[model samples]
Target: MIQRFKASLAITLAIILSFTAVFAGPKDTYASTVAVEAKSAILVDAETGKVLFEKEADLTLPPASMTKMMTEYLVLEAIDEGKISWDTTTQISQYAFDISANPEYSGVGLKLNKDYTVRELYEAMAVNSDNATTIALAELLAGTEGEFVKMMNEKAKEMGLPDYEFVNSSGLNNSHLDGNHPEGTEPDATNLLSARSAALLAYHLINDYPESLEFSGQTTAEIDGQKVTNWNWMIPNMPGSLSQFGYEGVDGLKTGYTDLAGNCFTGTAERSGQRFIAVVMKADSRPSRFRQTAKLFDYGFQQFQRKELFEEGYQIDGESELPVTKGKEDVVELETNDSLSTLVKKGDEENYTIKYNISKDKLDANGKLVAPVEKGQKVGTAELVYSGEDQYDNILSKKTNTVDLVTTSSVEKANWFMLMIGGIGEFFSDIFSGAVDMVKSWF
Candidate 1:
């Protein structure tokens, strides 16, 4: 009998293990398949800013030349706002000329007394990551790099970048500037950004100024009869060197490196009608950043697809109707104001659930909405809740997975006479119930 009992226990254990394996399969599938070898990394959908995967993405570190993306943004913004134009011209300062002449740095020679158009300087700054050209543009726009650094900081705050600091427009270690660091920052400070923050900046950059891609995507460009190649080796159809690292569908973005920051890249690629943005910080080498990014892109494109989880006007099962106080109707029907969609691992839609959050202010002390509610009035919100083992939120700090909950039809207030009659009936009914309870206690 004891031997038979052991056999039964073994069979039961096998059954339990099989159930666990079946349920846990999807969550473990894609995440374990891809790994990024970087100090910090993030992958997000370009259109929705939905984060797919992240590893220590909030850890802040020097971004090196990636900081130029912000400078590029402000330059384009200035042109768009009529403060500057593509044809607007500025001359190089002695300071800019000194930086440009350094062979150790990435630069194109700038003639100090020669005027350069915004288009020329911008191309150099964006394509070659030219430090002097960046400083020249900043000085032109803000009167000094010091004032431009202030604008950079203010703009970073406005865009809700969570972890960032700007010490110079050129993204050089301030120490490299030879005692000319921006006034508001530390003398030795370097521009810093988290991997997530870098990705967010790239998201805003391409979405706002898509034309920036025309410059960033170029494998080669010329300024002053000298051709400069983009440092991003992963750019499609790269010229002459490192073409093996070229990734298809890749276009404009940015790359950076420093003794302090290591190799970093914010890359964007579109394939199969979907676009993804990825960032890697403190990578081991130039090629490693691109390799790590390719792994993320492969996982994103292969394993995930955008799915509409709930349709517009979708109503919850038991929560479809909310009670209404002093209304012609006893309850009001509630439905989602907009459709909800999100990127999910393929075949994992069942892992998502809806949570309805009714606004307390919209209801009275009795937990019921008061009468005179109008159709389509927002009463609360329905938030998407992921029940999967691997869960992630959008890069945005604000609500991204939530939609407004609204009433399906108007609820008119009951007439005074009807309210009075109902109150009288309730008063008598309560008295009768109290008498019955009192009698039951005596029995």
Candidate 2:
């Protein structure tokens, strides 16, 4: 009989092990995959701002036309704040006409002294990387391009662009560094951005103004009776373009290039309800930036998952029950007040830990929950924290995500008779436990 009992115990242990294996979190290395051939790059989950991958992310480099993203953001913000109207016309200056308004330069064909609406100029600058169009908006918004660059810098400070610097709204720094501008507003001398900072700006812009995608994603637009195609080659197939470097779910962002900056792109792609932002800077070629960004997107979509870590009205621990004193029932169910959510990368879930902390104030002197409990009463909290580090050893978020714990249902006070019965049951349970201890001590 003893041997049979031992055999049964072994089977029970094996079953428990299987159950643990089934429910245990997966073990994974929280790290980026192969590197892209960009001088600096970073890929981040837009919703969570979690960096999935990065290379030289904080190294400052020229942002080229990407600076216009900030310009667009400011203009849009002004329009939203009622400071500027879409129909408001801005006049082109000799500077705007001299810099870009011809076949040699990419622009929406703004002639010197010609008036263009704010909406049309936005299209020209955002879609075609029109330097003149961006400068026109700058002059309108801040009286001069130099002053607009100053506003851009101040906005950058407010937005937490750690290593981002603006020299001009158009990002035409290389050519305009020596051009005439206000003494204090020359962004041309300081137009530099780290991959991480630039990606952050992209995140802010996309989240704040998702409508900007409608303009940036356009493959072609007409300006001054002439059709102009966006310089970005990742906008899928157009009528005349034979490029197949397009990616699905890639909506809008911005691309940049210059002799000193090489090729760069701040790309945002959404797949399966998950959006990822990738910034590739100083790539060897224009197509290389798009290809590198696509690589990051592919990895992001495949390697990470958006998971509801904790659910409302569910016990954080698989089995959690609290004994209630002088209540209609002997026990009550506990649940989380809110669901804690996160984008967990594959192979790194096991490292994510959830800790439950029950409130001591909720219990009586005997360590049992008292009667007359109300549902949804805040009893405690559960902290969900991720322990993954980026390549730079930077903890993605130093703060822990938490959810509140609460009672699932009310516990009315039990009648005197029922309370006496519960007390007797508890007394018997303690007696039985003591007896078992005595038996074990005999062994």
lDDT of every model, 2 decimals: 0.86, 0.77
- Superposed model 2: Cα runs more than 4 Å off: 1-32, 102-105, 174-178, 185-188, 239-242, 318-334, 356-374, 379-381, 387-400, 409-443
What is the per-residue lDDT of model 1 for residues 1-443, given as tens digits with 9 covering 90 to 100?
01223323433644564466456544334346677888788999998888888776766778999999999999999999999999999999989999999966687888878989999999998888999999999999999999999899889888888878788998789899988787877777778788889998998899999899888888888888899989888888897767999988888688898897899999998887789999999899999999999998888998899889999999999888999888899999999999888888987899998889999988889899889889998999999988876757677776458899999999999999999999999999999999999999998
List the candidates' TM-scores in order: 0.87, 0.76
Global Cα lDDT for candidate 2 = 0.77
Number of the predicted model whose TM-score against the real structure is largest: 1
Clashes of 2: 3
Predicted structure 1: lDDT: 0.86
The superposed Cα distance between candidate 1 and the true structure at residue 297, in angstroms, equals 1.2
Error of 1 at 77 (Å): 2.5
Q: Which stretches of candidate 1 lie over 4 Å from their true place?
A: 1-31, 430-443
